[model samples]
Target: MSQATCPQCHAPFTPGQRFCPNCGKQISSTGEGVIPTVAASNSSLPPTMAANSNEGLPPTMAAGSNPNLPPVGNSNPNLPPTMAAEDPANHQQPYSQYASGAYTPPPPPSYNGYPGGTPTPNDPYAPPPPPGPGMYSMPPIPPKKKNSLPWIIGAVVVVLVLAVCGGSLYGITQLFSKKSTDNKTQTTTDNNNNGDNSNDTATKSVTLTNLAISYATDQITFTSIEQADQFPDDTYTKTYSYEKKSNFVRIHMKEKQEGGRSAYFSYSSAFSLILPDKTTIKALNAGEFSGPKEGEQRENWVDFETKKPVDLNSLVLRLGTAEEAQMEFPLKSNADLSEYLPKQADLNKAFNYGPMKWTLNTAIQRYDAPGAQAKKGKVFVIVSLTASNPSSSDFWGYDYIRLKSGDTTAAPEYTSDDDDLNDLSAGASNVKGTLIFQVPPSDTYTLVFASGKNLSGTNVTFSIK
Candidate 1:
């Protein structure tokens, strides 16, 4: 808020001041000498500051009018004292700034060995200026976020691959080891068998119809394991329905007929799974089921558990029992049994035997229901027959007719539901029925009819297939 000083005398002056009081010089900061005007009326000032010098003035006759106010121009009483001289021929400092007068600017000063491009400093103690701004550029882009699902999936795939390779290697090792052990066991059994026949009991043949060796193995199935530290049951069932344990494993076996008889799986039976490390895991399910009959099957399940999953590679299922079991199908393999399954064969043929006209319909075998299924290595053959009794007397067909296959002969199965043709009354026409017989699968078969007492006098043979 301080005032500016005069450049001539260094005396302070206000903003609107037109002259320096101590030097008697006009100011040009008010733009006095910039505009053009008639020299007779122009009021102006000098460009450079001067204190006592009059070098810019020209020789004039009116000098001593008033020395204190610096000589007035031309002594023109009607004109202003600040106005320049009117004579165009005499163009000095103040008159040179007239409307028609010509003037020239002084040469610029030099600094730091270069031409003046920066402003001259008035305050010698001021600080230096700061450096200029830098060049323009664009902002940086942000990075994208990543998903974790693909990484998790890749990790899982790698784990599964490692597990499969390890399992396959373990299985191969166990297979070789099992073969070696079985060879040693067979050698020991042979040596023992040659010495005595009464030593072996549970694995000995009982009769011609029942043997001790393994036979028809049922579907052996297992379920995914469930692991827990606790269970909800005090006693475990064969199916592990209400029981649970750590590293639990359950296997289901159905219709396991051994040596033409059931395995006789009971609550007292001992079931186990042997591991590759010779560790045996005993079955936890000791629950009992009803015993199976002849030509039937025994269905059961075995459950085992341990504290940790160890030595579980290449397992072998085994069962042990008293002498009454007669059989046990352990360590079995999957085989194609499609040829043993019963199926129907269609046949339409007309023939005559004795007093009745007969039309043989079909011969089919089925195993869809219980007790109706054939035993292992055997099949059921039921032949449909349509008969017309034209005579007046009743005829019994069971006694006079017989079916034979290979070296085996079969009579009518009277206990079955297919015995309607065993007896035909008089005038009964187009009576259709079947004769059921259990037999083995064979291509050669014959049906025989006779017409004498006890069917022994005269007989007629009809080829079946």
Candidate 2:
């Protein structure tokens, strides 16, 4: 048979159903009703459907609303008593059974009313029963699992960064430390070598304090020493300025010396040092000293230096000219400088030269030269010379004659014809000429003939003091 639909809700249901399960509306078997009658879900059962009640209608006829079906009351002997359990009351009472604490599972649905199907034993599609009243409590919701992966990775990165930085810093520190240690070691070694060198110089050097030595015409007493920086010292002083540091000592007694051969001793080459190798160096920075007068003491400081280091202990004082230094008592330093001066011919004598024989007849000082006047602190010296050329080559007398002192030299005055000694003819035999020289008034001088026409190095010396 085709399934019938509920009238009020128009929902498809079984023909034997007395109410719609979806909308719970009562069904009429005779015809579809336009009016809807909804049963209250929690209301008490009607009197006609109550158990053991003598009502107007029987169970099967009222429960199913099927007019063609016979009534099956409790009085029917041919039907089972549970046959009336299909009533709507019995159909909706399963939930109430749970509420009353007596729930029981319902039987599987019958499929005999379905098309082409017999009743199956187990209906897999049946609705499950509610659990017993006290049997259910929802399983506790598990706490949410937390994730720590990002935190772990960040911590690892931080640790790696710190490790790299620490390693780099340690390496840099070690490098600097090693370099500093090496520098310190080198400095210490150099200092030790310097100390050894100082010891050696000390062994060779002699003490200078209060050491007195005798000379030819004077005596030298050394009182103190300040080593050199070796430039010329224009002013004389007992002490000096230096560049480096040393063990400096002071002198209570001033350094004293006496030399009278050259009255201007401090400005001349009077005091000198004789080295062990027989080499000599003159002192430049000495105290102001002068005088050939008797019993006169002069202050002096001997400053001497060399291009190379030497033994100071073997050094000797040479108080006069270097050619006349004395080592023992009668040493060469005892000779008068004038006696040891270079050999010179007498003014009245005739000397033979390279290509000529010349006689220096006489000399006289005047206030005026041939063509030029004498300077304020100067005088004019006029001398007559007789010359003869014994050689074939011509010679010039003016080119060969000159006056010389330590560093002062004067040429023949060339302002007039009388002063021109160049007029002496070549190869002449007896030529006489007058030459004039402007020189300082009060100094010792030498007359020199340095060269001739046919030769060189004539270099004859004559005293003109």
Please, what is the whole-model Cα lDDT of each candidate in the order they appear? Answer: 0.47, 0.47
Cα displacement (Å) at residue 299, model 2: 56
Tell me the TM-score of model 1: 0.33
Q: Model 1 off-target regions past 4 Å?
A: 1-249, 252-288, 291-337, 365-377, 453-465
Per-residue C-alpha lDDT of model 1 across residues 1-465, encoded as one tens digit per residue? 344655644545554345644343455633332222311232354431222222343332123332423343354343223343344344344454534443222223222211122223653543443322452445668787798999999999999999999999999999999799667646644543353332332121111111122222222233222222323432453234344434554444444342233434453344566644667667666323533455554555445665444322234555433222222222323323343344565667777666667887777654212223344444556777788989888877556567776777777665344456767888888888767665555775667665665334323233333
Quote the lDDT for 301 in model 2: 45
List TM-score per model, in order: 0.33, 0.23
Residue 271 displacement in candidate 1 (angstroms): 12
Local error of candidate 1 at residue 83 (angstroms)? 99
Q: Tell me the deviation in Å of residue 322 in model 2.
A: 40
After superposition on all CA atoms, how large is the RMSD of candidate 1?
17.0
Colliding residue pairs in candidate 2: 216-334, 287-301, 324-332, 324-333, 325-333
What's the C-alpha lDDT at position 312 in model 2? 40
